[model samples]
Target: MVERVTLITGAAAGIGVELARVFSSNGHRLALVDRRGDRLTTLASEIVAAGGTAPILICCDLEHPEACDDIAAALAVEGVEVEFVVNNAGFGLFGYATELDRAEQLGILAVNIVALTDLSLRFSESMIRHRGGILNLGSLAGFLPGPGMAVYYASKAYVLSFSEALRQELAPLGVRVTALCPGSVSSEFQARAGIEPGLEHEILNVSASDVAYAGYRGLMQNKRVVLPGLGIKIVPLLLRLFPRGFILAAIGRIQLRKRR
Candidate 1:
């Protein structure tokens, strides 16, 4: 049985919940964090019914600037020692930067860039001492500029950049940092990102569980970066081969559909 704790942000649903399940299966004790306490409780119950340990639920809106500090304080108070921190909680806006609500775009940066960065730094200090690992969720969108989801794409680009730098810094200390870049997954992300109800991304969508499993494997293998789906893995290469103008135009048209 794994005695080390793995704390996962956004553990109430989608890839976060899937991450929780995957980590739990490996016998890691989980501290599941999300804004939705009730949903987390429900998920905990299900996991318990399946003979897993009841996860400790941490309910906090990660949008608040101090959220990561607050969670760290709470864990300290609980005497919880985390072996892994999965920064998986994030959302995007599906519109032109000028057209989308300014607050919404900032909120995307808040959770995606700020909170994830804060948690990774704060937790990695301890992880380094213990020779543990961190897994950050990036996106295929991070490899290219996104016209419709400008802030979201930029935020993930930061994640990809940050994770790589941090990984190198932590490498000598025996602390692993893995960035999981996945293409679109069939999840609440589309609705939450304000994608159109009629928009279809079936061809690009991968399963959350698949991505979660790949993330888990990558983290265990001490891989620096993991592209979970075939489409996601091919994207960066394609980006390099295509002319910037052509790629941007194609992306613009695809993203424009979400705005309609």
Candidate 2:
């Protein structure tokens, strides 16, 4: 029997990698994408070694809008029909909005916002035709206003809103759309964002496996939003109850302390 395949972006590491593992274990083939070719190759090899099917590695920089089209074409050539898509590739940026470089900020927006949306639109059409599933990685930051990490927060906000809307639009067509919103996860994200490792303990931190597990379950159940931890699950409610000015002030204090 031909194996069903899932396409997962940012699959070289972090939650993306973990999600791939979960899907592969459940008997799905994978088309894993990441900008880091060497890492992607190594991850595929590791999965194969661990008794899972090796994933097809596509090492294209997704920041380029055309990359999604290229990926779609490449998958067609491989004769792989994506039964599921996990749009998990993203990065974080830290520093005051005024102090950050224009190029750097734009890069964050490109990966976190533009690339995610492009891939969702491109894949959602295919999934809808096939009646498949889509799980987009959002962040807890999406629920509340962020102060210092302004662009990253804004990008996640877009993700949350976009995923929710698309979920409703696609539900009648039998395409499952889930927004996986995880809190501070144990990943290289903090290092990339220039956040010190020890500071992670200060917040509610969950494992990549934990987040991936919740995401997988939610996708299968066709949940609209999947916030992994109990603490994070309550955050949306709290954010909604708090005054906007108060929320912003609280976020500002947290960001300021993190910078110190």
Candidate 3:
């Protein structure tokens, strides 16, 4: 018998960890994936301690070309099918696009774009068969042009576009797709992106647990996009009200501050 489970990537920390907890608490079997094996084991132990089923952990980095395939094979060996997918594994670098290492910039696309797309399409058949759902973690950055973190922002934009289109195509097949677009989330992401928490992050920041709950509820309700915080919800509207050039210039200035 194939056990159906929710597959959550980047499950070692931040929103992914909280998402795993939220889903598990709601009685979903989970398959947690992260590059950090130690963290995965700790999370598995935590889940077990909390009375949830111990999740199947696949500690593989999504940056590799074969990572998605490896995850699928590992799950197959465990006799589990992915009933839900959360494409939550992604990162960014803060700098001028031309200044960052060429390979490292490509690594951003590898995990955030290629791996995300690969996993979504890879599990579509199983999700459709089970009337399942996908919850993609997009960012408020997706709606605008980012200057400091060019590749990362572009990848998120792809996530937003692809998820919306996928939602339309899958709705007829009883599958749901939702993009969770939060503003400045307070997480390790900022430190890794070389971003300092400033007035912007302070004004728009949402907690990881709150974001996870919102994402879970939104996915269950089949919302095409979920913007968690009240502050974040207004951003898309604000973007529409502003001129592109003005928005671009504003974003560039904000990003430039990180360099100092």
Candidate 4:
């Protein structure tokens, strides 16, 4: 069991919960951050019941500009320097860019792109000194342009690019950065992203625990990018072999939902 302190965002449910379970089971102390106060408390309690150190519950909306400040302060007061930061607090709005409300689209950028980037940069400096790693939650959307989920795809692209660049910049300093890109995971994410249930009925989704374990192994191995599923690992390479227009059209059709 490792003793390093790990801070995970969006840790109340879905992939976040599984990630917490993985780290906690390995004996790593956690600082779980999420907007759901009740859920956060429940998650922390579950960890304790399972014999892990009581997780520090941080219930705050990442959309709020002051959220990171609060996190930094809370950890400082505890004198806890986080060795691994899972910037997993992100959500997607599945729709055309302009078709979605402007406010909603911007909100996706705020939480998915802005908050993740800010927190990683803020934590990376300390991580360099503490000698640990940072894991950013990216997606298959990052590699392709989604005609329907335009804004969400673009935001993930930003995460992938930012994390990869940071990985190179921080590597020489002994700090590892890895981007975890999983395909069609069985979680709240698809429902919350407005993906149609019938469309999802066709996908054989990977369990959140499987994705979490894959991410943990990749980060420990110091991999720059980890695509969890076999399908996902070949996607980027196969995509490059196709024309951009063809790729975009194919994905756009797949993203379309059947009428009920």
lDDT by residue for model 2 over 141-195, one digit each (tens)? 8887778889899989999999899888888998998999998987989888886
Report the candidate with higher lDDT, 2 versus 3: 3
Per-residue lDDT of candidate 4, residues 11-38 (tens digit): 9888999999999998899999999999
Candidate 2 displacement at residue 73 in angstroms: 2.3
Scored against the true structure, residue 158 in model 3 reaches a CA lDDT of 98
Residue 19 shift from truth in candidate 1, angstroms? 0.3
Which candidate, 1 or 4, has the higher TM-score? Answer: 1
List the candidates' TM-scores in order.
0.95, 0.94, 0.99, 0.94
Off by over 4 Å in 1: 1-3, 197-200
Clashing pairs in 3: none
In model 1, the clashing pairs are: none
Ranking by lDDT: 3, 1, 4, 2
Clashing residue pairs in candidate 4, if any? none
Cα TM-score of candidate 1: 0.95
Error of 2 at 52 (Å): 2.5
